[model samples]
Target: MKKLALNYVDTFKGLSKEVWWLALITLINRAGTMVIPFLSIYLNKNLGFTKEQVGTVMVCFGLGSLVGSWLGGILTDKIGYYKVMVGSLVLTGILFFGLQFLETYTQFCLGIFIVMTVGDIFRPAVFTALNAYSKEENKTRSLTLIRLAINLGFSVGPAVGGTIIVAFSYTGLFWVDAITCIVAGILLLKVLHPKKAKVLDTHENKKGKSVLTDIPYLMFFGCMVMFSFIFVQLMSTLPLFYEEYYHLPENVIGFILMTNGALIFIFEMPLVKYFENKKIQHLNSVIIGVLLTALGFAVLLYTASMYASILIGMVLLTFGEMVGFPFSNAFAVKRAKRGNFGAYMGLYSMAFSIAHIGGHKFGLESIKAYGFLQTWQFMAIIGAITVVFLFFLKRIIQKEK
Candidate 1:
């Protein structure tokens, strides 16, 4: 056990201090991200929103994410990632506080859209920042390290969020989320001053360098959208399924969701290290990861025992996340070296935005129209198709190699 512990610690060695600082800031920010996972329940139970209304609002959320990601990439390239990251964190914090006040359906839609646009602007800029902070050889581990922080925070957020909702109300989540965002922004600003931080100059001066024309990158982007389309149900419809279908309470659901983060925190770095040492192809890892994700979804098809099915499904999904996300990040970072890093990561982040915009709506409507069983089956099918998509992208990447 001691030997295993030492080996796990070794995975974190050699990363720059700034990378750790970035991970710290991300941890603080993500720790307060209690709203999104519970948003569907809040809208339905708290505000008495219909399923279709919730779907529309989620679409608005996705649209905002798409806009924010695009803007973040542009601004990061033009002005440097430092300005974008700090501004996004602080502004998003303020937005979350005000979000709870918007009561009507239309108001909620606009509020969520604006808030997500501001909040998600942090994504691409942070990816670019991490790239600038870490050494090349340790990049994947660095990515995994940040993901660990995120998952750790996510693990706490849902559990605490569930308790907060039960103790106070949904409004309490907004207050905590708002405060955390501002604190993270301030903490980052104080520690990583622009004058002292390693802010790389964007290559805007170089003409004709654009991600729009890159076919391979675009293909990768499509694959990510599909992957996210399947994965994002955790936030959108899955919680509702827990509440309505399995009849679990909020705290239980929160605990179940928290398991994803806890598992990733305990295991992702070592697993990423093993894969890196093996020199496994990034896309090949992604293929295996996607397959696990599909299997996770399929586990829900087991109707014998509800608790067993949900717990097993969560474990499979968490392992799939542990495997897939870091390598996808590394692949994007490597590909970005061929062009503008901000643009590449921005588009990469936007793939999630595109998925967020459509995925939630699709899942919700599927549930409304079909049923949870059919929806899960369809998502599993999408996951399989995404694996096929990743295989094609692997071919393109090899040709480039």
Candidate 2:
């Protein structure tokens, strides 16, 4: 036990201060991630938006995310990760406060879109910085640490947001989210060093290979889009399901949301270490994780009477999240050639962005057409399809190589 404890400490110790700070930045920023989970609820309940209208709004957010993801890559490589991070943090924080004032559908939709566009650009930069700061051997674990920090913050955010919603209402949610984002920006400014920042994104360093040209990566990217479509439903439809179908209160919903982060917070790092020591293939880990995610949603099929089923589903879902992303990030990092890492990471981030449109927009439409239970069932079907697609993606890489 002592030996294992020592080894774990040593593993964490292997990361540089920049990596550590980046994890802190992630924790701080994500801790305030109260807005998106509740955005659908607010739009529907408070703003009197129809589900179809809400879907349209999400489509706007997705369009912004698409622009952000694609632009984030080109910019990160062109300028530097640190500058991108700083700008993303401060500007997006200001936007959050702006959201509270918007009432019209047009204003809210445009606001949501702009917020997503500016805010998400930091994502690729964060990944790029992680790669820049860590030892090559410790890279995947570094990814895990940052994700762990994100979950830790998420555990705090929604749970607290739930309470704030009760005590002060949705206004409280907006203020709290905005303040933390700005604070995170300031902290990031103070901590990161001048020179150690910014990996040169010049074409020479990138070897002039575009991710668009890499067909194998494009296959993996396609599979990622499908995977994200299923996975993103947690943020999209699940909360609404809790309120409408389950008739749970906002705080109760918050607690359930907290469960995702709490599970990952407790189990993800140790699990990452376990899998790393086992020397598992990254692709296998993703496949297993995706199946577990599907199984969790399938467990939702038992929501016939038991509210406890949601809890059960979240466990499987959160664990699947834990197993999937760190490995998937590693797979992405491995595929990048030199300087194009930001671009690669951007494309990877775009998977989720695109899924927001496909998952949330299309999903709301599905719920309208088919109903919630059937919609969830279809998500599971999509998950299974994605798994098959990934297997094909793996074979494509093998054949191409």
Candidate 3:
């Protein structure tokens, strides 16, 4: 038992101070995302916006995310991850704090856009830095640890936000999130001060290849978009489904999401390690994950009375997410050009932005037409379709390898 414990400690010892600091900052940064899980609720209940209006307003957030991903890539390459992350976090924190004072719908929409743009700018840069800092052999574990931190933060954020909403107001959640972001930004500024490496510029010149022309990287990016398109439904439509169809309370819905994050925190690392050495293809992992997620959605369609059944479905979906998420980052890092990590991570972030936008638009329309259960069924079918696309993506990635 002691040997086992010592070995575990040694495994963590391989991580550098920079990685640890970055992970801590990421946890603090993401802990402030309390408002996101309840944004639709806030719009409907607190701000008196219709569901349709909320969906339309969300489009601005997606647009900002898309722009931020592209800009982060270019700027990270030029200025370094440290500066980009710090600046983005500080700017975004200010916007989030300002959201508490907004009254008009237009102002709320603009605030969301500004917050998303600045928040997303640090995302790709931070992930790129993590990849750069990790040893090749420990890279997957490092990424897994980061995911675990994110899930841990998310678990706390929503539960706390739910309580705060009940106790005070949605504005309280916004203020908390803003303060967390500011603290995270300050910590990151102190810890990450490395000079910009010129290796990517040299590689681009030597290979005479445009950064955007990497075919495998593009395929991976496309895969991220497809998966995120299916997954974003959980946040956008799933809560509404619970409220309208299941007749569940807001706090109950919040608890369910907390469960999802908690499961990821507990199981993601072990699952990633299990698949790390296996010859199972990256595309295969994606297919399996998406299929499980889709099946979970399908199962939810059959359960009308039992909340336990809904919890079972959540288990399946969370397991699927665990399998899919870490591997996607690993695959992207593997396929990325040496020293151009930021650009590749940015492309991945862009895929997620596109997916969220598409999912929100489709989910809102589908829920209106078919109702919640049938809409989830439709999403399940879309997830299965993504699995089919992965077969083609696998061949492309293998050829590049």
Compare the candidates by lDDT and give the number of the best one: 1
Q: Alpha-carbon error at 248 in model 3, in Å?
A: 4.2
For residues 1-401, write the lDDT of model 1, one tens digit per residue.
99989988998998878888999999889989899889989999889999889878988988998999988888888888889999999999999999989889999999999998888889999998888877778889988888888877877787799999999898889999999999999989988886667633233335536888889888988888888889989876988999999889999997898787677777888899999999998888888888899999999989799999999998988888888878988988888877777788899999888887788779988999999999999999999999988988888888987
Clashing pairs in 3: none
* Candidate 1 regions with alpha-carbon error over 4 angstroms: 37-52, 100-103, 161-175, 198-208, 239-256, 302-312
Error of 1 at 384 (Å): 2.1
User: Across residues 1-401, which tens digit of lDDT does each residue of candidate 3 receive?
Assistant: 89866654554656666677778888888878889878878888888999878877788879889888878887877787778989988887888888878777898888788778878988788877776677676677787788877877877787788998888788788888888888888877666666422122222323324447876667667767878887888776887888887799988998897788778765676677677657566668777888888888887877755686689888988988988877787777666654366777788779888987788788878889888878887878888887877888787766866
Cα lDDT tens digits for candidate 2, 9-80 = 665666677778889889989988688767889999999999888878978988998989888988888898
**Of 2 and 3, which scores higher on TM-score?**
3
In TM-score terms, which candidate is top?
1
TM-scores of all predicted structures? 0.88, 0.85, 0.86
Model 1's alpha-carbon lDDT is 0.87
Query: Any idea what lDDT model 2 has?
Result: 0.84
Select the stronger candidate by TM-score from 1 and 3: 1
lDDT of 2 at 271: 85
Model 3 lDDT, full chain set:
0.78
Each candidate: RMSD to true structure? 3.0, 3.6, 3.6
| lDDT, ranked from best to worst | 1, 2, 3
